[model samples]
Each structure stands twice: as C-alpha cells, then as structure tokens.
Target: MATGSVKIDVHHITRVEGHGNIVVDVKNGQLKQCDLEIPETPRFFEAMLRGRPYMESSHITSRICGICAIGHATASLRATEKALGVEPSAQTVLLRKLNFHGEMLDSHILHAYMLVAPDLLGAPSVVPLAKAAPDVVLRALRMKKLAGDLCAAICGRHTHPIAMTVGGFTHFPSKADLEALRQRLIEARADVDATVELFQKLKIPAFERDTEYIALSKPDEYCFIDGVIKSTDGGSWPVEQYRQVTNETCVKHSSAKRTRHQRESYMVGALARVNVNFDLLHPKAKSAAGALGLKPKCVNPYMNTVAQVIEIAHCVEDSIQLCDVLLSRGVTWEEPVAPARLSGEGVGACDVPRGTLFHNYVIQDGLVSGANCIIPTGQNLNNIEADMRALVPAILDRRPEEITLSLEMLVRAYDPCISCSTHMLDVKFV
Candidate 1:
C-alpha cells in the first residue's frame, strides 16, 4: 500500500438528490477520518403531519420528494387508512400497484440513466452523455416519458399525485388509456434490454462487503406496496415494529440521523431488495439480472445500479400484466371507503425505488395526532458510511482523483435522496 498523508474534501457531491459532502483523511498508511456528511436542513415532515385531518396526510407528505412522491403518498395513505380502519377495495389495490409500478419505472430509469450512467460512461453528467450517446439518452427519455404518462393516467400527475386518497382514488383511468399504456409497456422491453446491455458493457468496480440487507418481503410476489419488514439477518417484523428495526440516532457530522439494526449498519434499496427477494422477481427481470451477472446475496454496493436495471425490466413486464388484470376485471368507479373508526394507531410500509419506507400515524378525533416517516435514504446513510469505511482503505493506493471518483460512485450507487432523509430531528434548539 502506497499511502502517505491523503485528504479528499468534496464540497458537495453531484448527481444525487440533495446536498452531502465526502470528507476523508488518511495519514502515513493509517486511515483516520471518513464521513459522508449530510448538511441538508431537516424538513420537519412528521411535525407538519401533526394536527392535519386524516384525509390530508397523503397529499401533504407526498411533497417530501418530487421523485418518490407516489411512494410517499401511497405509504401515507396506507397509514391513514389503517389508523382509521379503512380497507381499500380490490380494484383500488390493483390500480395502486400499477401506479407504484409507474413510479418504480420513472425513478429507476432516472437514476440508472440520468444520474449513475455518467460515471460508468466517463462523463461529467448526463448533459455530456446525451451529446456523446444521443440514442442512449433518447431511449432513457422515451421510457421516462412513458412512466410519467402512466402515472398521470392513473394518479392525475407523476410528481405529487392528486387522485389517490385514504381508501381509494378520485379518478380511474379510461380503458383506452390503460390499453394504450399496456401497448407501450409491451414495446418498451427492447429498451429495457438495451439498458441491461449498456450496463453489462460498462465495468462496475469490483468491491464487496458483507452487510445485512432489509426490505419489505412478501411470500407470493416481489414486494413493493405491502409486506413484512424482512432482513437478511434472519428476522421479520411487522411495520409497527419499525422503530425497533431502524433505531435511528443522531450523529455529529450529519443533520440526518443514522440508523442501525442487528448490525452497525444495514442496507435498504435495490441491492437489498434483490438479495432478500430474488426468487420472487418476474422471469424477465430474472433474465436481466442473469444478463447483468447480478445474483442473490450480492454484496457490492456499485451493483445496486445493476439491480435497478433489473427492476426496470420487472416493472415493465409486471405493469403489462397489471394492465391485463385490470382490463379483464374492468375498471369500476367506487366511493372512497369511509373510516370505520377515527381513533387508532397504524404503521405503513412500502418498498420504494430507494428501499423500504415506513410511515406511522396516530389518529384521534378524525385528525392526525402524531406521525413518523422513516425515509429509505435515512435508513441507508449509516450503511453508506460503513461501506465507505471499508472501501477507503482497500483503494488508498490509488491516486487521489481515482479515490474520489470511487467514493463518489459508491455514494451514487445508493441513489440517495438526502433532503428526504433529513426529515425530522429529535432535538430542540434554545
């Protein structure tokens, strides 16, 4: 190992959701300080949910992230519905799953194409990649547009959805709209295959560290909207026990709180989900994973990008099936289910594009008396640091620029939404 005094100070990393700095120091062949410092201010989403009417939490908290807004809204609605003792109809469930698939396609494509692809392609950003690989960029844009339109057709818009409510949706997609979307999804398989091939050609760094993986787990299907919180560490918990699994605590360097469960840190996202639920993936997605050389129990953080691409295939294929199911059953208009009771406590969990997200609510007198939202990025922050601590030393022999790039790629592999992670604090300032 050829290491003297080395310091890497990235003022702010690019190609992520929000602000964060990577600060590393190594002295005389000895590692010293390494931290992924998050400086984004806390967003107080939980506090804002307090005292809001039960019907409003979904719409309000969806603003937590423009990218994962549908995920947030879905989780928020689940929590509200459970708290108020409202069970969604079967039709509602199918539509919500399709809507969730739209977001999964939108976000995974955005990250895999616009954010993480630049690093693998040796470009500064997607702007350069667009010029150099116009066809590739156009494919990404095409898929993204389809995903957004899918969301708009069902949920009224891609960003913060307007139609989804506590028990059901305000509007349903027309048969023509659903049929058109189904056709488009069927056509997108070639693009998804191209995406897999592109990543297969690009070399991901060879790095691996065994860490615990966690995500929402369902026995019958690959999970997203609802499942138990399952961990690779060999335990499962209901959504209500998420606090025990998360164990979020404040750290000195980051405004975002660090989380741990059964280990110093654990991972939650595409890699984790793929590891925890690989057998449950759709056959096409499994083929994509096979093509990308991604298999269960994958430990390399960089391969998270690869897993995301696999999920895109899954989303497209699954979306087509969902469209078929909906068409066969026929879309029927139904009134939103009213709350059977207004006083209860409930927790909701969803496997978003990022990872397992949890929302807990306490309802009293038809209003939200308390709320807690554990973001996927927040859950992954500590694991990122853990990965960094392991990775920095292994690559210390490389030049500073190379080291910095490796670290940047490591962070981007998580596809973190930092602003969403920094949502809530347990401190009171005088």
Candidate 2:
C-alpha cells in the first residue's frame, strides 16, 4: 500500500494441490494484513496413523497427498523402521533411492508442465497448450509417463505404491526389469534438457528476499533418502530434533501451521536445496543450472521455478547413476522388511519433491502410539505470505490482474501439496 487502496481475494488457487486463497487488505496506502489462507478443514492424518500397526502406517499416511504419496509413504516407512530397530540392506537403500528419484521426477514434471507452464505461456491450462504448443505438451506428457513407469517398475503402482514396505520392498525389480527402465531414463535425458531450456525462456520476475534456507544435507552427494536436518543459519540437527528447528506455531489466518527458524521466515524445496547443496548436484543438472543462469546462494523466490527445472535435470542424472550402481552390484530379491515388536521413538527425514519432510513416530509394541508429520508446504506457508507481503507492495502500482498473477505465481512456485499438511491441527472450544 502506497498511494491508493486495493483489495485482492483469490479463492482456491488453480493448478495446486488442495485449496488455498490469497487475501490482501490495504486502505489509504497503509497495509493492514496480507495472508495466504488455507482454510481447508484439517485432514487429521496424524490421528489416523495413531494405533495403526507399524506395517500399515506408511500405507495410511501415503494418502495424505496424491501427488506426493510416495514421499509420505517413504517417510512413514523410515520412521517405522527406525522405531522398530530395522535397518534396510544396501540393495534396499539403493532401490529406495531409485524410488525417491522417481518421485522427484514425477512431481517436478507435473508442476513444471501441468501447473506452472500455463502461467508463463499465457494459457489458462494445459488443455490449451495441447493446441498451442503441441510438441512441448507432448514431450512433457512423455516425460511424465516415463517417470510414472519408473515408479511402477519399482513400487508396483504409479500413484500409491504397493511394493514399498517398512525395511525393504515387498518385491524388487529384476535386473532385466531395471535395465529396461534404465534404458528409458537414458532416452528421456533429451526431454529433460528440453525442459530446462524451456523454463529458461519463461518470464520469471526479479524479486529477492533474504531468508534462512533449510533442507536435508549429506557429505557425499545430494541427499534425498536420508540426511541430517540443516539450516542456512549454520544450525544442524538430527531428524528427531526437528521440534527445535521448525518451531511450529499456529496462525489464525490458515489451518496449516507456519514454521520459522532464526528469522520470521525460511524457504524449503528446490530453492533451498540448490542454495545449500549445489555442488553435489549431478553433472548434467549442474550444467542445466549454469545454462539457466542459476547459481548457488540465489535468494529470489521467483527463481524457485528455475531451481525446480534444474532439479529435474539433477533427478534424472541421479536416477541414471543409481541404476548403474544397482546393476553393477546386482539386485537380490530379499524378504520384505518386517518389523519386530518394539517400544521406542524415531524420526525419518528425507527430501521429498516439495521439500524436506519429517515423519516422527512413537511406537508401542509395534503399533504407532503417536505421530507427527511436517510437510514442506506447511513449513513454507509463512514464507509464501511473507513473499506476498513484499511483492504486493512493490507491484502495487501495476494493474490488479498483474498483482493477482504475481501472487498466484508465487504460490504456484512452491508446488504446494496442501492436502499433505492439513491434518496436523487440534482445536478445542475456548
């Protein structure tokens, strides 16, 4: 708010998971309040996990987000495995990495093509893109299909995977099967490169906000399946210490809780990962990042879309490398990871598509006694609104449609899976 009055109320932002709204109130050039309100009824996924058997918790929590089903399931499995004192074999870890890479590819391609592409292309949705940029749309579809097939090969289903379990997969893909999938991945590299080049041409706004970045960090490579929680402010903690870093608090404007570290806001997802671990990116992804003019320590929220494009390249190359390792070592079909009756607490932390996700569990005699799952979207809720607060003021002089588009694009950049985080609240009458 500077010289005039404006009101922007956008309900249920399009091309994102679940429902979210942007609300802004300004009067006489004074900012009253600006918020991204997710008033969706809390989904209560935590409560659902409680009292469920360790083997069933992943299957139950995997329902939190249709787009991120594998991430949720992976987190749940890691937590259950840890609490039950189960350690997966080397082959299991490698296979899980493959599954993780596939999840990343699946979600990133969907966001880049189906959700974020229309905004840059000036199309209402992907439907029009089919008519306008038929080849581009077709390529995106092929990329998505290829990634989905990888999931099916590894997890036994494209959407909600059935093969993943507590300590290991119920079924492992044969060498011949993995080799086939590897060939498809190798073939898809050209398309992934095209995607990076495509996003490079998009018109992303130039806006910068200095904030803390958080993600899972490892010493050897870009972490996906496991790593310690890290913050850009030089704070490092184990997954079980998440309560200290997240410092989650309730806000009346949204059902999803907001998170903060040393500052009022912190960013997660691809941007944070790139900011922290750019060196570990696969060679192909690193080249894509350079081509797109993206470098480490990027602070612009709008560049998150670019970061995602870079991440797509990384996931693809990483997937190929994982395939090489699996084949060289040879895969073995081991017994499904079965958990023994135990009483303890454990936390599973991993880099999901949206960002770093944590699933903490307290198990009593092999049944989940309590659960807490922190999703990337939930962590970035405060940051998104904070970006909005900064953005609307800068573009207040622009047209209303421009303002709305800016805000909507900001949210879409997060590729938020709102449904994954909605169920983490408890309310009582005051």
Candidate 3:
C-alpha cells in the first residue's frame, strides 16, 4: 500500500483586496479535495437600499465595491434609467462610456502590474519592480493616472465619483477640458503600445481549462456600453432575460453565492469578452488582439492579463474617437424625464473590466423596492476553484511553500474581487 499526505492552505491573502482562502488536501497518491472558501459577513446593502429614493441608488450601490466604483455607479444608473423609462442622449452615452473606460483602464493596470505581474517576475510585490525598473513602474503609474484623470473629467472624482445620474451627467465637460483629455490620450498611445509588448513577453503558468465564456454583444461595433447577453457556445438572451440564464445559489461552504448556468459553472471577464466579441472589437483593439495571438475564444485564464492590456489599448483609441466626435459636434447635455409611477421590473448589464455585470431592480413608486447585483467575481468563483483543483495534482510533489505560492498566484490570475463578490456581506474566516 502506498501512503502520502499533503495539505496547503492560505489563511488570509494580502496585497489583493478582500478576504478569501484556498485549501488543498492530498492523500494516497490522489488529490483528495480542494475548497475555496469565502467567509460570510452581512453588510445588508440590498436591505438598506429598500425605500431609498431612486436617484440615490447610484451613490449607495457605488459603495458596493471600491475597486469598481465606476462600474457599480454605471450599473445603478442604467437600472434607474430603465425604472425611470429614459434613454440618455448620444453625448451622455459617449461620456458614460469614457468614464467606464477610464475605470476599466485603471483596474486593468492595477491587476497587471500590481497584482499579477509580481508573481510571474518572481517578486513579492511591485515595490521591487519599481526599484529594479523604475521606468516600467513609472509608465504603469502614468497609465493609471490617465485613467484617473479620465474618470475625474467625466464623473468629478476617481474613486467614488458622484457626477453620474439616471438621465445624464449632472455636469458636462468644457471643450478645452475634452480637448486636453483627447491630446493626453493621443500622446499616451505609445505607452499603451509599450504595455501591450510588456505583457506579451511575461511568462504565464500553463493551466488551461475550458468553460463557456459570456459577454455583451451588439450587431455592429464593440458592445462595451449596451448589448444583449451572449455566450461563446452560441447561447444568448436579452439583457432583460439574464436572470433566466444565470441562477445564483448558496453553498454551505462559501459566503459568496456560487453562480452556474444550465447546471455548469462558467467564466466571464476580459477573456470572455474578447472571445465573444473578437469581431466587434475596435480596429486598434483587433490589431492588438492579433499581436497577442488571442483567438476568437481564449481558454487559458492566466492569459486574461494579456487580454486586459489589449482592451486598454482599445479603450484609449475608442476614447480618442469619441472625443473627436464630441469636439466636432460640440458638447450637448439633456436631462431625461423622471418616472413618477415606478411599479416595474427591469434589468441592465455592462462589460466591466473583469466581466459582464448584471443589475436587476424591482421598483415601487419612486423608490427601489428590491435590488439584485451579480458581479463578475461571483461568476468566476467556481471556475477559480476548478482551476485550483486541476493545478494541485501537478504541483503536489513540490514543497509546501512552493505549492502555496502557486495556488495563491492562480487565484490572483482570476483577479477575483472578493469585496465586489461579497458586497452585501461582511467576511469572517472561521
């Protein structure tokens, strides 16, 4: 009889936001089990939101995730607009896309340089990268700042901007302000180019798992702002029908709800979006995707960082085009009508940097009666665990410390935002 035993566990993961754990058990020459746990702590975001004025939902929900504040805010606004029965003007849509792109860029850079790259480069943190390659670190900072500036210009603040509203922005950007942003984005094109090259050269782990990819899709052009929910397996449903496709259920072991579609776990985020809408990507984005060797469907989760960099370039290029359109036509703003009687249900979804985010609302009178928010992290949780399962057997022979590091690195590759996943709850590990 053969006998062996190994166990790897991470009690508290640092350097990445939120709280979570990875546990692996090996026995008798076969992997025993792998469990990913999210501790439950109740924040009561939905319960507290009950009876709040519809206009305030954006501000309130924006608190759900600090890392993706703009995403939450944008989702809230879209829901409120649906409840209020208003479609924002063209300029409003463009401006909102710009703000979202900035947030996406900020998030992608943070994940690429700060979270994921360190592991690939064998560094504990980006601090070492900052010392060894000051220029690289500085470029990341500059790119991040550009994203912040774009967010500030559109929403009045980078972290938790309050300028976004249901109908349209509370304020509009001046021509000079818009022009300055345009020029800055134009100048930063080279930086974006460099970033693409930098990510392409990084060595990523070889762990490939196939899962259904989901993202928003439109008939023409990349569907970043609005579109029906689409999947790589040729399954799609309207945005309003997302709940029918996505079923969230509670697991005894996890504080975060496990999401599955048709009884199978699925994947979302940059790779999913890139896979589902490769044809719809902006021309420059298409070029970058080609350069990165990303196909119509990308299965390796580790390559998500590369897809994110391609997306950054796409967003910057798209922003420049949007600015050109805005400058040529001049700035225009219009306030939409507020729905007086709001007894209805509506759904809204957008392509955040991580993945597809869905928001559903049940409104009564002029207040939000019930709200359900499905973030990308929740969708990717099961997939992350599955990847960990596949990775453990291969690394079981390695030292415990090495095994732990590999497991943690795999988690970071998903770029899981635990705060966003458990927005309505407080996390506590038992």
Which parts of model 2 are misplaced by more than 4 Å? Answer: 337-341, 424-430
TM-score of 3: 0.95
The lDDT values for all models are 0.91, 0.85, 0.80
Better of 2 and 3 by lDDT: 2
Candidate 2 lDDT by residue in tens digits, 362-422: 9998788999999999999899888888887888888777888888888888888877767
Estimate the TM-score of every prediction.
0.98, 0.96, 0.95
Q: What would you estimate as the lDDT of candidate 1?
A: 0.91
Per-residue accuracy of model 1 over 315-347 as CA lDDT, tens digit each: 899999999999999999999999999899989
Expressed as tens digits, the lDDT of each residue in 75-175 for candidate 3 is 87887778768777888888888888899989999999888877877778999978887787899999999989989988898788888988888878889
Best by lDDT: 1
Residue 338 in model 3: lDDT: 60
Which regions of candidate 3 fall more than 4 Å away from where they truly are? 1-3, 423-430
Report how far residue 174 has shifted in candidate 1, in Å: 0.6
Cα deviation at 110, candidate 2, in Å, is 0.5
Decoy 2 TM-score against native: 0.96
lDDT of 3 at 223: 75
